[model samples]
Target: MRRPGSVRTLLSCLSATSLSVGLMALGGGAALAAPDTPPAAAKPMPAQVVAPYFETWTGQSPAELAAASGNKYLTLAFLQTAVPGSCTAYWDGETGRPISKDTFGRDIAQMQARGGNAVPSFGGWSADTTGTELADSCTDVDAIAAVFKSLVTTYGITRIDLDIEGDSIDNAAGIDRRNKAIAKVERWAERTGHSVQFSYTLPTSTTGLQANGLAVLRNAVDNGARVDVVNLMTFDYYDGAPHDMAADTATAAAGLHDQLAALYPKKSSTRLWNMIGVIEMPGIDDYGPEETFTTEDAVTVGKWAAAKGINTLSFWALQRDNGGCVGTGGSDSCSGIAQDTWYFSHTFEALTAPHHPHH
Candidate 1:
């Protein structure tokens, strides 16, 4: 509910270590999509991959995000359409117009000028048609592509994240339409000499992506879309256990490593790991202590991912990284757990410090 695959048969078809060479031997199975003809230019990732979600909460802004972590990447959350099918207008009031800039537009420009860039994340639990919902309302894939193209062109963003969750993740038709629309965008990028990377942000089980989530990723590749990253929202399992948060995270990421290796047969183990992202929800979750994610856990997971070369590391809203809570329950502004200001943020940010460039 928050910020939020495949298997043995394929292993017999090819080896995980030398998957790149095995694609031709296997005639390009489900794992391969016969690299696009003439080969399209590779879509690019963010200027800096590690970006925390910045959204509705007190004490959180683009400037706050830039100032807090000192990192170059920040994900400006929830850029959706004003209406389900109204592609020309965005939910943030920055309609495809000139002169007047909405809060998001102004702040993003400011953040960019500070040597930091942002990824316009489409979707969240809030109102507005998420990326999938917007695509579902339109049958014209080109139109859908145009909406995203305008966003990337206007904002100068190199990547966009599709945070698919709730009803949107299971909408099979929407998933297919969304994938087709993304494929069109990739093609458009190829023609325009712009590098754009598309990332899917979804929920995960301890073992990795659940069935619907797996389907979402498969839909992307089956429809001829290249997924640059698969970011897992690794909290709120809601199983009601006092689980070892960091251990679960490492296990979940390992499972995803295997799945990515299976999905992209030609990718090396290290490269596949580099395409994985983990989004942590700092402090006590809505489920309380049964699902707590402490700062110590953040450090553990950060070091684990850094050592393994994980693509990006982020968390839920940065507003919750403080200690304004009066009790141990979920709050939008501050972490329910007892902690100092910016404890989680600083710990996780340290994982991406200069000495740890591999992260």
Candidate 2:
């Protein structure tokens, strides 16, 4: 389920329990004493990266989706974070107290069997177990970093995403803690010779990333973290309708480009663009009919992202990539708009060149 409003709006309503550990910290970046060091070059991706959001706990299993699509989609992002009290990542609503590798091992194996990859996402709207919350609960930052490393190594995935939002995004203390822990995680990867990539999934307004959103990026560099990509949830703009969904998303992405230019002054303009991404909620959004992201909108955004050489292109979910629930209000089961199954996915996939690798 989506939040009642944009993350910024929800920040004010959190209580002490939640505030003790939050995720969104919109404060201006604290000036660091050390001169900024050029961030390590993000690991090279295929000619074009087209990874779609795969809701592992939703409509169908990763293998099922991949089979049905005839392996047209090779990379899928599994939705979610692990349990809150422990470092283990598990599917939301499962009864297991301490989740283990078996929790999702079968599904992971199934996807990999079909030549597909899973990007483990931390934190989403439907769960209380956020990435920051998971990190805050840990006594040792290394332990938290270990959890991330273990998961990455276990799953054979080269990339991971931190979707910080809602109460999780508002917690300044939690934000710092999470950044530090992730920095350590990157360090571990470097020292162990484990190649890994990191991306942050954040909310945004039409103009660009909100104050706290910007802080999340700055803090990464300030804490000596390597962020491969800054992904924007380019949907639900303040929970209202926008004049043009595609244009609004592109404008916000452009705004982010300028912000990154300042954050990494030495990086070339093209490299900065490659360090950015856009994640959209196709079709009718939870906000209501006022905002409709049509298949055409996907094409528009795809073309712009491709032309701009953006690092990644994905959407809110693959479960809703069908037209079964058109105009049925917001639904996790479908995009709530009329469209053939896999149409939206195919549209976005077209953004990449034909030679780009796909399983």
Candidate 3:
């Protein structure tokens, strides 16, 4: 389910499987060049942060909206190459929008100044299905790793979210390469004393992650990729049935907790719960009238997520937290149900407290 502004900058994604031929030299850009200026000391996100997806393609400043919506941290969405087979990634796949302080540097810094940081997310639905995703289009593991390192140096962000969906979930070769790059990045982070965490945002069935989604994480574990979080997009079930949106959110997360337990049996129940994240499709999702999340659901889930101590509680997007378009499904601008603007943000952002003491 591609977002409204997804198709504006897309190119055919040719499968370029050169495979892990060891570490390859980074392509042009600061991927290999030393930073023009020294990066300041980093301010990592809180262990429990509510970072809703911020749509970069909408020509809106994430910092401006975060301030208006009372959200400090935002997960900037969809960084990939404009063209497939290109190792170099750009925000929203825009060639002119390469990573630099001139781009989102000022805004990201402002968020950090306020005790929050922007976590850049890569590979949205359009990129995943089209093969423009960094790991899918570019087969060079080293180049992929280099780009990730640059994000840390340029923005001082502590976490990266990988929103793998559709075709990319089943890409065995891409999964292997991505996990290899993650291992490399982790090693680099350890040496440089940077706290970098990777979260995989995968689509889930009502029960749990389907087979393809599981395969992605399995490869990560096999390749020694430290998965700090497993975020599930709990919207857009598309089963064409009326749903108890809030209850379904609970069941879906519970199923994921079981899956995480199976994946890492050594971890305790609290740790497995902490490793989880859920994205609610506020208002109506892409499945028309079959799926809807209400304002009451937001309040309920916020309290539930904090009590359960889930690492993250986010929505499909920050921009869609309003009631501008009633009965709409998947509108990029507003939530399709009746509610005040920024209602969801106001409800969920409080969970960022490092210690969310339960009542």
Candidate 4:
């Protein structure tokens, strides 16, 4: 129940294809820098450590998010367009509206008051260069970078996630444009003396590179762009095919780890920040009668990922699966509120807890 335009703030999309390709290339090239001798085993931390993906439009107050998530790290979605000294376009829910810098500042203050981190994200699905476009034109990288700098300074945010999506990655110019944008952002960070971290959401499959998006990421890294992490969108690959949830999660995690390790050896530790979906896609029916992820299913996947040394996990949404569909009356329906609750609470517990019974 986000106010009409709330969600737009989190509507940015990132191309998954580009990220996979870049990581693959880096992983394949050189042996990562390693100490000659093996390092000692590091003890695992508690399992309650979890990162929650939040939609700007959920209309939920910052206090509500903090309460539901138990003060875990929350990634607030897309901050679409930025006007020089004016307002920025954000989605409260579905409606797009211009919001002032001060208003956004107040929102962040509220989030911080709840013991949460508020990170601004850019780019998202349906980014047809209209509502949430970062730059007026592709070549306006400097301008875009300036806007990002302004956002960080204005809101006192330290991390920024870029979620570029769509067909803008189909040509040489597109790739260059994207790369320049990344570089510009990096330059801004360096000059401003801020620890502005950058991450991108890319396609899960490496084969999806022919789309030109992957090429953009590869070129960016090749040219020395500072990308801290890559979040791989692994779901949504269903094509009317039956999928084994546990097995698919395992395979995808393993494959992504291997590929990313091989491509970007230097940044191998920054492997797939796997995107798990809790909501059912509109047209897909392969994930059983009622789609979505269950608590047991989430735990299974979390265990599998933990065993493989993949630590970062982000759900597609926090508000969408608010433990509401738990006891609606049918086998196909969700198990109960406990399921949704465990899906997150347990997943966090699993992540932060010691790894006694290894996956």
Candidate 5:
């Protein structure tokens, strides 16, 4: 489902500030002309890098993860509630889930140890919580603002990613609701005078009416959200048989890139980050009983995205494939479908290697 190549073409078309402004307006920002000063020549695109908003789950200690990953640019905690339970703001530690506040402190400590940035991600695939509810109850605009202030004060997190997903998108009145929620968060951050980065994860493709998809992103930006990066779900494109992993990722990325380019031109500032799904969920679709992705396939997808100028590549999960799954032969083997995970790390290293252009 990840189409990096197509996204690249979309990036190419965004050469005019008016178009960029237009797309921003579509996302909900008021239009402004490109600055009158001659814009500086575009900086050479850096070699694609891994913006690992590392997903931390139950049984994994933040301290351990910091040691393992060596503290990257962004570390994210994937918080969720079991089925039939409504969303809650804090992590249910008793249930092994870390609350936002808890995760924030632990992650900050880990980042300090590992030397990378840590931020809290509110939701995941099963997260059905609404931003409005989070803002209204747990922390009002001012309190929420204060919380972030404390985060910067205590742990020095420079970014915060809002990874809300699932049916909650459909609950929105329109793009405006999503934009307003994000705007509230952004305004709070701004009021605190912190240069915090904001990002979101939408649906992989245009399948649902859920606001967590591309259409919702288009509407959110059109209304007034000031999100910095839009990370598209590039995996889970097929359900049945294992689809051609590279092809699907490229297609998803390309499609998303094109859509954004059409809507916003010349705004390369809004970078496109690709999410590659490495977890092999079988029997869910036509992809057969079970199948796993190869590391080579993951690398191919990354290479394709970079060739097209889409520099960011993130993997869906970190834990699922630690042991090989269905189509991957034996458990713990890194060959066959299991290779997909191995390739993800390898590809990231290769892409971000020193002297590599397009970082």
Candidate 6:
């Protein structure tokens, strides 16, 4: 399932727009825990984190998989409205998983109890296209901001990831509403002494973010929102050319570095790199053989990510880290390549060292 919410391909999931400057550069550093201190629920998202996307629809406990995968941080995939017209968002758009404490609340608390956390993400290919994306479905800016606030208060989590792809990227009104809500939430966080950060997870071509993704950031800047991390889906280029998945990630990230340099001109090159995040699909993506990310590639990217001092290193999912379905192009449960389970997780988790990020 080469997809977001399962991305079959990124080509159809994207479009372009112009770009801006902003504040809130995400550093790759976190406060060291006191030797005798208890694990805090309000742990700040590390300056550099290895948070792979965790698919929520699979009925697996996120904390359980995270523990199994050796991932201290997992970006929970998609909280969107159950219907196209609703302002309320539910996990996987399921009513049973509404924005309530009963929904994955304990799971998140459990993760935090130890020293881990989940980055709750919004919008995926399904939500972006079906008009279920929050900003696209709900025009009320206050309501959108309320939902974001709820996550902070309910989960005590620090970062929110917006996986904007498909028509959502091309959507001007939705883009503006989303960013405006982001600004609103950031302002509230600042006033309340809450530590919250927002990350944009958008699709990318081989070189970098195309126009549509840039437009979203431009809107965020125009609306006075702070974008902490710009996570790129470095897979699924879909340009009908052979891909060196690892090399493409480097090129794409370098391209994003340049784009980010312009959008955040006031920041230093190091800060701009620190603001970057690269998400690989792990094994074969929706585009088949041409875009396969071999195990060796994962090794390359992981070490490269650490050396570059990037903000985050992640894959399409935690579940898809095994070699259960070899030769397959896309499968939600396996990497489709020969590799040990949790290989990607173990490889990239090194970037989260207490001493790394150099900031």
- What total of clashing residue pairs does each candidate reach? 0, 9, 0, 49, 49, 14
Q: Looking at model 3, which ten-residue stretch has the lowest summed lDDT?
A: 9-18
**Tens-digit lDDT track of model 2 for 142-166:** 6667767765555555677777776
- Write down the lDDT that model 4 would get: 0.46
Candidate 3: lDDT over CA atoms? 0.79
Query: Best to worst by lDDT, what's the order?
Result: 6, 3, 1, 2, 4, 5
For each candidate in turn, the TM-score is 0.80, 0.80, 0.89, 0.67, 0.64, 0.89
When 2 and 6 are scored with TM-score, the better candidate is 6
Prediction 2 TM-score vs. true: 0.80
lDDT of 6 by residue, 1-359 (tens): 12233254322122100001121222222332342232257778877889998877766788788888888899987788878778998877776667655667777877887698889999888788889889999989999999998888777789999988877888899999999999999999878767789999988887889888888898999999999999999987767799999999999999999999998889999999999999899888877888899888987887888888899998887878999999887777788899998888888886776654533
**Which ranges in model 3 have alpha carbons more than 4 Å from their true place?**
1-38, 353-357
Identify the runs in model 5 with alpha carbons over 4 angstroms from their true place: 1-49, 52-55, 69-74, 80-88, 92-107, 129-154, 174-178, 206-212, 238-242, 266-291, 321-343, 357-359
Question: Which digits, one per residue and each the tens of the lDDT, describe model 3 over residues 215-302?
Answer: 8888888999999999988777766678888888889889989988988999999999999999887888766667788888888888
What's the distance in Å from true for residue 359, model 1? Answer: 11
lDDT of 1 by residue, 80-132 (tens): 55555554434332333221133344555556666656777766544212332
Winner on lDDT between 1 and 6 is 6
Candidate 4 runs further than 4 Å off:
1-49, 82-101, 113-115, 128-131, 135-138, 169-175, 206-213, 266-291, 326-342, 352-359
Tell me, what's the RMSD of every candidate?
Answer: 13.1, 9.7, 6.8, 12.2, 12.9, 8.5
- Sequence-dependent TM-score of model 4: 0.67
Residue 179 in model 4: lDDT: 61
lDDT of 5 by residue, 52-92 (tens): 44434333454455455432544354433333322244332
Candidate 3 backbone clash number: 0
Cα RMSD for candidate 6?
A: 8.5
What does candidate 4's lDDT look like per residue over 10-60, in tens digits?
232322111121111111211221322111111111222345556554344
